[model samples]
Structures are given as structure tokens and as C-alpha cells.
Target: MSREKTKGMSIIVKTITRLTVGLVLLYGIYIVLHGHVSPGGGFAGGVIITLSFVHLVLAYGKDTALKKLSKARASFLENMGAILFLSIALLGFMGGYFFSNFIPKGEPFHLFSAGIIPISNIAISLKVGAGLFSIFVALVLLKLKPTSEKKK
Candidate 1:
């Protein structure tokens, strides 16, 4: 296959994506981490994170995006996130309730102030981000499959 056929998009789009994709991923992480103190939380941050990968897929094609994060890895991360969140909630039983705030609440407006909340947010972001990305990948794969195979 020719270079243009294998690689996706124009050089300009690829260059711009290379420059901005990391920033977009970082912004998503920032949102997830600061969810307790800011307006954006796990769900919004997850969407942003998924967008970063989607951007890559659009700019560099499915092959490149899959190389960065394969279907198996995405599924693994999604499962891990759910497990972590569940473990956190289950641990709250030690505090006499489900999903209780067992960790010490530090000073307000600080990074570590919310304790378990931040941790929970991280777990949620992982689950949401990976799950959404997995869904996107599945849809892409489905669309790309041969119609005869799909019918079988």
C-alpha cells in the first residue's frame, strides 16, 4: 500500500494531532484528578480521554490507534477500574456503611483534601474512559468488517 493509503489524513492534520493529542490527554487527566475540587468529574473527563484516542484514530487510522491501545488492553483496563471502584466501596464497610468516607478529609481546596473522593473519581474515570473507548473500537471494527462476514 502507498504511504498515503496506509497513513490517515493529510500531513497537516497529522502534525497538528501529534502536537495537540498529548495536551488533550493531559487535560482529561487533570479533569479526573481535580474532579473533587472542580466542576468536571469522571464522566466528563472520560469523554475527553476517549476523544484523545478518537482523534488519533481519525488522524492516523485504526492501526495506529490500536497499536497504542489494543482492544484487549482497553477491556482489561475497564475491568480493572470496575474492580478498583468496587473494592473501594467494599472497604467502606469498615467505616460502618457502604461507600463511606473512611479516609481522612484534609484541608479544603487542596489536591488530597477529598481523600477517597479523588480515588473514586480516578476509578470512575478509568472505567468510563476505557469502556467508552472500547465501545468506539467495537463500532469501528464492526463497520470495517466485510458484509458477508457480518452476516455469517
Candidate 2:
């Protein structure tokens, strides 16, 4: 008989995960968006975002977490994040120095204010979040390899 793929943890754990994961993701996005105005920035927010996925992995399993976010997709996102951050930095050349604030800063406290801060925060968040996830996946995959197979 063919063994079916494992889905996740028990019902209670899954139910809680389903309820809380969205909130965690939302908070991460909020932190990223408000990085300029508030304390939390891309790195912190990205870590939180990564934690949400890691929570899934811990609660459910690698298979379930990976099913939601495949390795290939995570790699692609990580690359995209780096490229985007680099592009933003490069764009600063048009303004003046590296990562210069090119756009006009609106009235303080508004969403569009702080010029490139929010955008940069977003780019950094993407990079950090995806990078962390990729690393986790790599470690997990490496651990899964059979010890005896290494000798063969």
C-alpha cells in the first residue's frame, strides 16, 4: 500500500495555527509598512514573517509548510528581493548618493512620507523573510538525508 503524504499536526494545533498565522503575517506586513514611522523595520518584520512560516513547520511539518511554499518559489522570491533592493539602491544614483531619497517626502506621519524608506523596508523585508525561509528549508533537507547514504 502506498503511504499518503503527511498533512500536519493534530486538529487542535491546526485549528490554532489557522487562526493565528494570518495575524502573524499581517503584523509582519504592518511592521514593514510602518518601519519608517515606527520602531520595527524590515529586518524585524521579516523575522516575524519568517517565524510565522517556521511556526507552521513546527506545528504541522516540513511537508505541509513546504506545500504552501515550495523551495523553488522561495528561492525565486529570495533572488527577487535582493534584486529589488539593489535596484532601489542603484536608483539613488539618479538622485545623488547611494540609496538617496529620490521621491518627495510628503507630510509627516502619512503613508507616502519618508521618500524611499517604506519601499526600501519592503525590499529588505522580502529579502530577509525569503532568505530565512530558504535557509530553514536547506537545513531541513540536509537533515533528512540518510546517514548511511552519505558513505555510498
Candidate 3:
């Protein structure tokens, strides 16, 4: 918690991480956006995004990483993601089909072509990414006390 000790890793590691984390996040978004046409989908892309933050934690330490993203925010975002995904599914009720693709599908291979699929993919990515981040935060923050300490 000391100010002096709260910094990240060595200069070299920090330099490399600073350069790479943005690219990792960008790639994750790309994967999510292109899910309908590409092999990678929401879950895979979300995991990739989560791992990038995890990489930051590994390189920088809990304090430094938590400053950028707190456990509470992660939990809130996870819930929001789930809600968004559910809402997208529920919209299908208007069309009388569960998870129906209501929006018009445009030209194939185009970024905006897949209608609800892309939206669903975004929702799933948010859910998956926030869930994984929450898990990572929990695991990193947890601490186990000795049995004797509990008795006292």
C-alpha cells in the first residue's frame, strides 16, 4: 500500500506490456466483431480480452492492476452484460421466436451484415469478459487465515 512500492514491474517489462496490452484488447474486439464470419466468437474473444488484463496483473501486481479495474466495477459490468444479452434474446418475443434474428441481414461478409448476431456477440463478449475479470479479481484478492486466528 505504500506509495513507493505501489508501482508496476521493471521498466523493460512495463515498456513491453504498455506496447502489447492495447494490441491484445484491439484483437479481442476484432474477434468479437467478426465472430459471425470468422472462427472466433464472443466467448473466445472475451477470454482473450480477459487474459490481456490478467497479463497486466501478472506483469504489474494487484495494486497497480486494481487501480485500472476494481472488483466492484467488474461485478457490475458482468451483471450488465448478462442483462444486455437477456434483453437481446427477449426481443425475439416480438417475432414469436426465441432468440430470433429480427434485424435484416445485409450483404454477406460485410461488417453490418449479420443483424442481431453481431449484437448478441457483443453482449456475450461483455458478459464473458467481465465474468472472467471478476473471477480473476476474486482469486487474486482472496486470503486464507490460519485456523488458530479464526478461533481467537
Candidate 4:
């Protein structure tokens, strides 16, 4: 059985929760796009996005979201992101010096201003998403019972 939810939720509260979560997710995407010239980056934006899932878990309960993603999958995604980030950096050394930008640098403050920065942002996003997911799975699994059938 699921744990009892405290108190009766008002319609206003439910509406606000849904609206807030939606807004946060949108803002997270914005931050991810403006990361090149702005204060925020992929990692920060990704963390912000992950909070939406946390909020969902809080409002709807962990069981619903837990079924969507498993720990092993999350861990694999995280590892892939790390590899992508490193591969981008390694590409720099392929030309001559390390950390060099092979891609062209467009106008400053523009979407393509920083070479590889956007790619890095994408990688970081993947890493953050998966890392948080892994942590959430670990936390949820700790509370679940181990089901088994053994010979007596």
C-alpha cells in the first residue's frame, strides 16, 4: 500500500504545482540555450530541469516516475555523457594543441558564438539528468523490500 498523503489538497494548490513545474522546465530549457553568453550553463540548466522531476515525485509520488527509469539505465546514460564530453575535448588535440576549437567561432553573444560550448552544454545536460536519476533510484530502492523465493 502507498503511504497516506497529508491533508486534502485544494484545487488551487494542484493548479499552482502543475504551473510551477511547467514554468521551471521551460526556464531550464532557456538557460540551456543561453548558456554560451549568460551566467548559466548546461550543468546548471540540467540541474534545474531535474528539479521538475523531483517536484513531480513530491506531488505525484515516486512510484509513478520510478517506473519510467531504472538505475542501470541512468548510470549508463551518465557514463555516455562523460565519454562525450571527454571526446569533445580530445578532438582539440587531434588537430595540434589540446583544448583547441575545431569548429568555427561565430559572432559573440550569438547562439553559435562559442565553439564546442553548446556541445559541452548538451553533454553536461545528459550527465546531470542521468546522475540525478541514478541518485533518485538509489534512494527509492533503499525503501523497497527485496522480494525473493528461496528453498526452506
Candidate 5:
């Protein structure tokens, strides 16, 4: 493969993808942290974050996204995040029934408030983001064919 013309174009695309993905990640973090006090939650933030990666895959290509993140790793993260959230909820059961606020709820309108809600949001964000991102990647990869392979 010649590294001439493709270099310049790839550099530009890489820069744009990095910036967009970074912003999306930051926004997702913000939404998750403020879930207890704001309208958005883990699920919403997660979707937004995943969309960022989807954009990267679309704008740049599946190969670039896959280079940054492996399919297996992404799937593992998604499962782990779900497990973490479920474990937290199970812990609450020990207190009484379920989701019993095992942690101390600070004050309303504060970061420390909402006991386990904030944590759960973070977990869900991780699970949903990675899961959705992986799904998108799989679909894109499925459609991509080696350039060397000529059509019949």
C-alpha cells in the first residue's frame, strides 16, 4: 500500500475523529455524574457516547475504530458494567428488600447525594455505551470488504 495521498487525508480524518470522540466521552461523563440532579441518566448518556464512536466508524472507517478498540474488549466491558450495576442493587437487598440505599445519601442537589443512584448510572453508561458501540462496529465490519477483492 502506498502511503502518499492517503496519509494527508487520513491525518485530517484522524484529527476530527479524535476531537469528536473526546467531546462525546466528556459529555457522557458529565451526564452520568449529574443524573441524580438532572434530566439525563446513564442510558441517555451512554447512547450519546456510543453515537460518538458510531460517527467515528462512519466518518473514518471500521478499521480505524477497530484499531482503537477490539471487539472482545468492548463486549467484556459491556458485560462487566452490567454486572457491577446488578451487584450494587443486590447489595441493597441486604439492607431490606432491594435497592435499599446501602450507601449514605448526602444532601439533595449535591454530588454525593442519591446514595447508589449515581453509581448505578455510571455503570449503566459503561454497559450501554460499550454494547452499542460494539454492535455498530459489528454491523459496519460485516459490510466492509477488502479493497483488493474485485466484484464479479
Candidate 6:
């Protein structure tokens, strides 16, 4: 197949992906935010977020997906997530414990009721999502390298 033809999947698949990708991303965010109150958490939410990108790549090709989230940006986000998470943990020192809950815990079963848990979840989600996406991009590049070399 020509490079253009090989870039993405069929139009039907692309259409479906376009329709659903945003919902997938939204759901991931929901998972991350509600993790402290529910079953899902940072890791699960991050995987969901990564899958949204993966779906985009599968349906619309790497060029489109990379335009949205470049590898460099992904690395930056990963680093920022790590720094944020570490900072949150370090701040707990003021509470006289590592990873202690320093912020006020509001009423139960409500948003913002978990002190720093939601913030930590956001940090973990950023780290895992970007890291996983970067790994996927690297693997995709690695697979393409040998194929292009063979053609050359």
C-alpha cells in the first residue's frame, strides 16, 4: 500500500473513533477525579487516557495524533507530573509525616472531600498517561524503522 493509504484505518473506523475519542478522554478524567470516592484511581484513569490517544493513532494515524500530543510534550508532562507528586508528598513534612493529609477534609462523599487525594490522583494520571503514550510512540517508531529500512 502507498504510504498515504497505510497511514490510517478505514473511513468507518475513523468516523467511529472521532465520535468516541472525546468521551473516552472525558471518562478518563472522571475516573481520575472520582478515584478517591470510587473504584477507579490514578493508574486506571491514566490507562484510559492513554488508550484514547492509542485509539486516535489507530484510526487517524500517528501524524494526527502526534500533532495533538508530541513526544516532547508528553515527556514534559510526565516530568511535571512527577514533580507535582513529589512536591505534594514533601509538603506533608509540615504535618510531621510522609504523605500525610495536610489539607482539610470536607464532608464525606463529595468532591474535594479527600484532601490531597484528588490532587495526587491528578498527578499520577498525568505521569502514567504521558509515560504510556511515549512508550507506545517509541514502540511504533521502532516497528516502523525496520520496515522503512527494508524498503530503502
Best by lDDT: 6
The count of residue-pair clashes in candidate 3 stands at 0
Model 6: per-residue lDDT, tens digit, 1-152? 67786678887998899899999999999999999999999999999999999999989989999999999999999999999999999999988898999999999999879799999999999999999999999998775335676788
Q: Give the per-residue Cα lDDT of candidate 1 at 74.
A: 99
Superior by TM-score: candidate 3 or candidate 4: 3
Write one digit per residue (lDDT tens) for candidate 5, span 1-152. 66533532467677887777888878888898899898999999999988877776776666666777789989999999989988998898877868788888888898889788999999999999999888887776676568765754
In candidate 4 the C-alpha lDDT for residue 86 amounts to 92
- Candidate 2's residue-wise lDDT over 1-152, tens digit each? 22343455676988899899999999999999999888999999999999999998988888888999999998898899899989999999999989898989899988779998898899899899999999998887785556897789
Q: Is candidate 2 or candidate 3 better by TM-score?
A: 3
- Overall lDDT per candidate, in order of appearance: 0.94, 0.89, 0.89, 0.78, 0.83, 0.95
C-alpha TM-scores of all predictions: 0.91, 0.87, 0.89, 0.77, 0.82, 0.90
- lDDT (tens digit, per residue) of candidate 4 on 1-152: 23455433445665677789889888888888789888898888889877877776666566655565556777998999899999998999866777688788888978877888898898898799789867876786677555665433
Deviation in angstroms for 95 in model 3? 1.7
Q: Give the winner by TM-score: 1 or 3.
A: 1
Residue-pair clashes per candidate: 0, 0, 0, 0, 0, 0
User: Which candidate, 3 or 4, would have the higher lDDT against the true structure?
Assistant: 3
Q: Which numbered prediction scores highest in TM-score against the true structure? A: 1
Candidate 5: stretches off by over 4 Å:
1-15, 144-152
Decreasing TM-score order of the candidates: 1, 6, 3, 2, 5, 4
- Candidate order by lDDT, decreasing, is 6, 1, 2, 3, 5, 4
lDDT for model 4: 0.78
